[model samples]
Target: MRTVAEVARMIDHSLLRPELTTGDIETGCALAARYRVASVCVRPADVPLAATALAGTGVLVGTVVGFPHGGNATAVKEAETRLAIEQGATEIDMVLNIGRLRSGQLDDVEADIRAVVTAAASAPVKVILENAYLTDEQKIAGCRAAERAGTRFVKTSTGFADGGATMADLRLMRATVSDTVEVKAAGGVRSLDTLLAMADLGVTRFGATVTDRILDDLDHRLRDRDGWTAA
Candidate 1:
């Protein structure tokens, strides 16, 4: 069984809400640092602030590329990736072109992902498939495209989508990608149960807003050895 700290290290505490002020980002970064979470995934503009805030905290700084909508031109996504990395971001989760994938523009989609991966340089790039809008075949193809583009992970959902990560989708994504490409699930993973469930399905990372709540609950459960369900 995984320890609370182990699970905590897998969380990429999401600070991507649109209305979040600088104060909110500061607070979120502090919380993530306190918990020793893997990274604080912030917005493009918040990268510098997050990096500065987490400078001595041993936590990584991450950001999104093309964000909630994956329709940005390939050049734009590449620019976003390069700038974020320059701003101190090391983990990048970029949105996939759902429209292009659905339209069977496999070459375009692969090219898009490759652009971001190239711009990411040595940093890892995670491709968000927004599984809510895709069929199983599209998901597989998306995974394959991400792998071909040399991305590190195939992510599910942007939270702005109609739905978030589901076990079935995560399992399928894991099955589709090679061992070199891992999986990340975002949006709706609010509790320890949900996180561990996805972990069991081969998900290695999560974008979460409730980092403290989940980690605290895990700590309490471990201390008491209680049958907590993370509800």
Candidate 2:
């Protein structure tokens, strides 16, 4: 197994707080830099600033489209996706319309994701199912919808919902999505054990606010272990 520090680099260091200021995003970017994280997931309004701040760094810029609540108008979400990409965002995470999907309005749900996928173009897109609000059947359906929409990833949650990602949910999602599509287990993903466990379950990416802590734990262990082999 890889050390926690090794896995921390796959995390999209997230800051989705509504009240977070530019300074807070700057701090978040600095932390990502220190940890050599994969990317910094921030709000749309902060995307340009983050892109600029992270300039010349390997960390990519990411943002949410429909956000915690996937109830936004489809056109609105598409516009947001387009604008974010134009602003230099390397990736987009879009929330599925939970109500529509639950009601079995699969067309609307599929179209919603398709629009964003079209707008995102070459940039990878992650569809957030907010699985805590979904049943097993709905989760399966959402994964199918994401596949039909050509999304690059199927994410488990927004973390703003009552619950976040779970081992059961991640395993289910992994089973549903094709080998080509990736799974991102987000929300409630903290600590080295959970991170490594999820990675072993086929999750190549993670979204979390505990990124720094995980990296710190990994770094401390790395120093003690002499090399990553012992970790």
Candidate 3:
């Protein structure tokens, strides 16, 4: 069984909802610090707030580029990435051009991701495929483009799509990317079992809003099963 910290590190506590206020970002940062989760994937405008709040807490600050819709021009996405990094985003979750991928324009798709990867400099980039809009062939192509562009991870969904991460999609993504490129599952990862199941499929990161519930349940289970206590 994974320890509380291990499970915590797997989560990228989500704070991207448009309606979230500054207070919500602060509260979310506090929770992330308390649990020592991997990072907080915040909205682009909230990067500075999250960065300041999480500073010295060891939790990374991540922001999205291109967001729910991946129709932003490549240069615009690149500019967004650069500005986000400037605003203290240590990690970037960028949405790939879903339409381009679906249209079979693999080269343009690859270039779009590469631009963000370039602008991110040293920051790790996770390319969101928004798999809900993609067929298996498009997903595979997206994964290949992300890999070829030197992204650090390929993610499923932005949580705004109709479908979230499914086992079928996770399996396909895991199989598509090489070992050097990790997989991230977003959407519908509200339970410990779901997170564990995705981890079993080689997912190393998750985006979730239910960070507290998931970690609390894991802590309880570990204590009951092994007399384990959180540090």
Candidate 4:
């Protein structure tokens, strides 16, 4: 039985839609604050607004660097990271160059991630694998590249992909990376049961647009006390 607060703590409380208005970002930040979520993941352009909205609260302000796709140039990603840091983003979730990773250009992939990590300075960088596109071998290679690049976390997907995080991918990532680095399971995480299952698999963070729904589910279950118990 995952509690509302427990589920909140694991969520990134995502608001990455390009069509999301400024008011939507504000609302998302407010929800994150009210729930005490781990972070609010918004688009790079909205980082400053989210940061301002989340001020005085301990919740982190996270933004994507390479965004939904990792096809951008390395210099672009670096500049994006630097700009995001300047805009008060505390965490950067960067998309790795899937093309490069799949081409077996491991050094290029590592360099791309390293550039962002360097630009981010003291802020943590999470390299998104966009797992739905990769083979198991490619996934392992991506994790290894991110690990070598000093990424703080290796994330599962962008949610734009056809699929999202899976238990198989989660376990593979956990086994591949250093225990010191974190695993953020993003994409399609919807219910309390799935969240708890991922947590059990060593995922510390989750990115989801339906975070409030998950919280609501937890609340409803706890209030009923008929089908579930406290976590």
Estimate TM-scores for all models.
0.96, 0.95, 0.97, 0.94
> lDDT of candidate 3 vs native?
0.95
Candidate 4 per-residue C-alpha lDDT over 1-231 given as tens digits, one digit per residue, 9 for 90 to 100: 766777788899999988899999999899999889999999988988998999999899999988888999999999999999999999999999999998999999999999999999999999999999999999999999999999999999998899999999999999999998899998889887898899999999999888778888778878778665545
Each candidate: what lDDT?
0.93, 0.91, 0.95, 0.92
Instruction: Name the lDDT value of residue 94 in candidate 2.
Output: 97
Off by over 4 Å in 1: 226-231
lDDT of 3 by residue, 1-231 (tens): 899899999999999988999999999999999999999999999999999999999999999999989999999999999999999999999999988899999999999999999999999999999998888989999999999999999999999988999999999999999999999999999899999999999999999999999999988887878876756
Q: Candidate 1: global Cα-lDDT?
A: 0.93
Q: What is the alpha-carbon lDDT of model 4 when measured against the actual structure?
A: 0.92
| Comparison by lDDT, 3 against 4, better one | 3
lDDT of 1 by residue, 47-70 (tens): 999999999899999999998889
Model 2: lowest-lDDT 10 consecutive positions: 222-231
Q: Which candidate has the top score in lDDT? A: 3
Question: Which candidate model has the greater TM-score, 1 or 3?
Answer: 3
Instruction: Mark the 10 consecutive residues where model 1 has the least summed lDDT.
Output: 222-231
Candidates' RMSD to native: 2.5, 2.2, 1.5, 2.4
User: Residue by residue across 58-102, what tens digits does model 2's lDDT show?
Assistant: 899999999889999999999999999999999999999999999
